[model samples]
Target: MARRGKKPKGRPVNGWVILDKPKGMGSTDAVAKIKWLYFAQKAGHAGTLDPLASGMLPIALGDATKTVPFVMDGRKVYRFSVRWGAETTTDDTEGPVTQTSEERPSRAAIEALLPDYTGEITQVPPAFSAIKIDGERAYDLAREGETVEIAARTVEVLRLEIVDQPDAETTVFEAECGKGTYVRAIARDLGRDLGCYGHVVELRRTSVGAFTEDDLVPLEALMEAAEEGRERLDAEAVEAGAKARVVDFAPLDDYVVAPETALAELYEVMLTDEQAARVLSGNPVILRGRDAPVFCEEAFATGHGRMIALGAIEEGAFKPKRVFGGRG
Candidate 1:
């Protein structure tokens, strides 16, 4: 017999859902769809993909939302196509073409130009972007026909390799970039640097953090599964054929990088069980680890009062920052 317990509704499912976002749907729309499907009380996405782009989008359900920032901070890889001789207002096919040229650079020219952008560089974001300027979104300002002058921010381009040169008019490339790097902006900048107008004709995120396209589930499959009584579906079966599918609870740790991974660069300060309990109760503890310089600070609980990990030392031992595994 099926185990009798609380129904799935409002019963938060911990960990992340790697969604293979479909094109033409907004990222938030996808999150809302998943939230409704899972009947989860809290849900958030680690990163946003443009409506024109598609691929892995990590959706954090329940307490996992607290760790979304860590996932977002991880590097991203993308496979994209940039069409030469055309510039768009939004740096993508969805936007209006503002300018065009007859000249198309050869693959050799494009490859040679890549070196100029292959390392740490400053990139000016597209005006029709989510970047905020003076308390307003740059896209909002651009929509209002207002001038939006955004400062160029430095971003690392770990790699930019030409995967395919279909023709002199278009170049297919793959890039691995740090957080806040924009592929659309890369398209725009590459065009400008090469003395030709360009915009991304196709873009697909291959990976975000440790999640990848191979781990995503199609939204349609998810919707169908939800309609077919999601609770009855085995977690393993749900993930069997999809890039993103429901994972078994036992392997939840595989999908979620423990919060401690965020503090890998920091010094370790293990605590006694009593010290951990005290930290859970909102008390600062002193750190006495000999591996690093001695310091003192308070470690406090983080995210929905779940004490699962310890915080950095300030005036105390690393205290319980998050707690997990209890009746919700």
Candidate 2:
């Protein structure tokens, strides 16, 4: 007989965790922490949030990782504060100040420029960004003391408004925009247009797709929950007088959101056991009845409350695009 491969460590936990990522932590680091907390076998994030920014960072564990692309395409809402009178190389407080201006714009001047940024607009990304230049990250090049010129691209900004003005030197604005929109770029451009060079001093993301501020769970809370769960497990093992006991990971279920939450915008179809089996086997099923969707570019199916697959509908037939399996 052929030798069996070593089993992967950790449980096969599946779900989304809308982490309220704190500043100074990278997106990848946050995902690693969450994966360890649940002892999950696999994990990924929907969007990349910088170390200088905080707020909703949707992390997917196990099977939920398959839906990362959908979440990445969802709208993002951010509230950031810009400090006038100086421009930094990174377009944020993280970089050195390269320029300074004594000019300060009135509230009315800021309001008038909001319309220009709203709707479809062309904007250049910050030099210290993740954009690839000749297969190398732009930020890496910039850090190496190399000048990087990123091309301008069009991004959709649904809404932009001045939410607060703390003083003559700072202005806070909130923006709702589509994928690829950078809040740092907005602050940089606004400062330049107002004749007072500025850079982002504070940033916070409040929403992404189906996730909102209400769903955010601070990192401290997750760590505390994990520590408490481990303690409870140890106590139970002691009481039972067992030398060895299997670890139970059910306590952290409360923090895990349904995987379907990321695909809220897609239509959902309920499938029978046989139909679900077919879908899991990489086959399509014919949807029946008058209420069945005739044509849909993207949709999902569930069988007995378990997600079956992500697929497309054509002439009432649901074609499985990506089938899910092995428990959520």
Candidate 3:
């Protein structure tokens, strides 16, 4: 007789895991590995990466999972190589060759076309993506040989620069873009604009939101460090050890920047502790200084008494966008 019953599992803790995703592993796979490694209560990644791509993949564990949407809205930067004269079904290296051309443009020609994509532009996501259509995954529909119509989305290309233009068959470039911009689509659209077919051969995300590759820890190294009792350490030690690892694996407090920090670039504001509490409680509080930027956004918890973030005043009152302290 075999026993088939539920086993005992402990509750999962809340935290963030910045994974230095390796090529050939999908984002979901990475999350599963981390979840298993930590026995996390819950885990999720801020964004998805194709199996063929690599780079920073932020994994939110525990309560951090609740913040995934906010983190996903942050901008991203990538370095990728585009191969000209060829197109693929998935728009990347893993896809089967759908089309190819004999003509390849020169470096100058490719550089000239870069400007066309430098600013805000409309882009269509690849059909072989996670996008949903009629409540079904687009990739699922695409795999079944069904043609799916994906609407074009507007994305901002903050920066687009050619890093290397080796001949004309391949071009290595770097791009910084806002959320929802698909690099594969950029390659595809660039090919269309340049009068040639193109597909992404290699893609590496350098930054996402306020996080960069410099802040990621390789899966192998992270596993080793965890085994060495790194995970049981404090925030200061984590920050110190991160320098040696050549990655920023510091705790959530280090990288989970406040929304007010981003807003600081827009305006500045200051608020009293009492006013901050009111704002955090969902009630707007009036500020004295109107001309000067007011910082009223407080992420601190009412119970814990530790301050997290201070937000700016928009109209006449203080609005707390993110509170970090207390139970969270």
Which candidate ranks first by TM-score, i.e. highest? 2
Of candidate 2, the 10-residue stretch with the lowest lDDT total is 242-251
State the weakest 10-residue window (summed lDDT) of model 3: 297-306
Task: Give the per-residue lDDT of model 3 (tens digit) for 67-186.
Answer: 576568888889999999988988898789888888888877887888889789888999998999999999999999999899998889989988987766899989999888888999
Candidate 1 residue-wise lDDT, 45-144, digit = tens: 9888988898988888876776677678888899999999999999988779998888788787888978878789899888988888888989889999
Q: Ten-residue segment with the worst summed lDDT in candidate 1?
A: 298-307
Residue 224 lDDT (model 3): 66
In model 2, the runs with Cα more than 4 Å from the true position are 1-6, 232-246, 326-328
Q: What is the C-alpha RMSD of each candidate to the true structure, in Å?
A: 7.7, 3.3, 8.3
User: TM-score of predicted model 3?
Assistant: 0.74
**lDDT per residue, candidate 2, 175-209, as tens digits?**
99999999899999999999999999999999999
Deviation from native of the Cα of residue 43 in model 2, angstroms: 0.2
Per-candidate TM equals 0.76, 0.93, 0.74
Stretches of candidate 3 off by over 4 Å are: 1-14, 230-328
Decreasing lDDT order of the candidates = 2, 1, 3
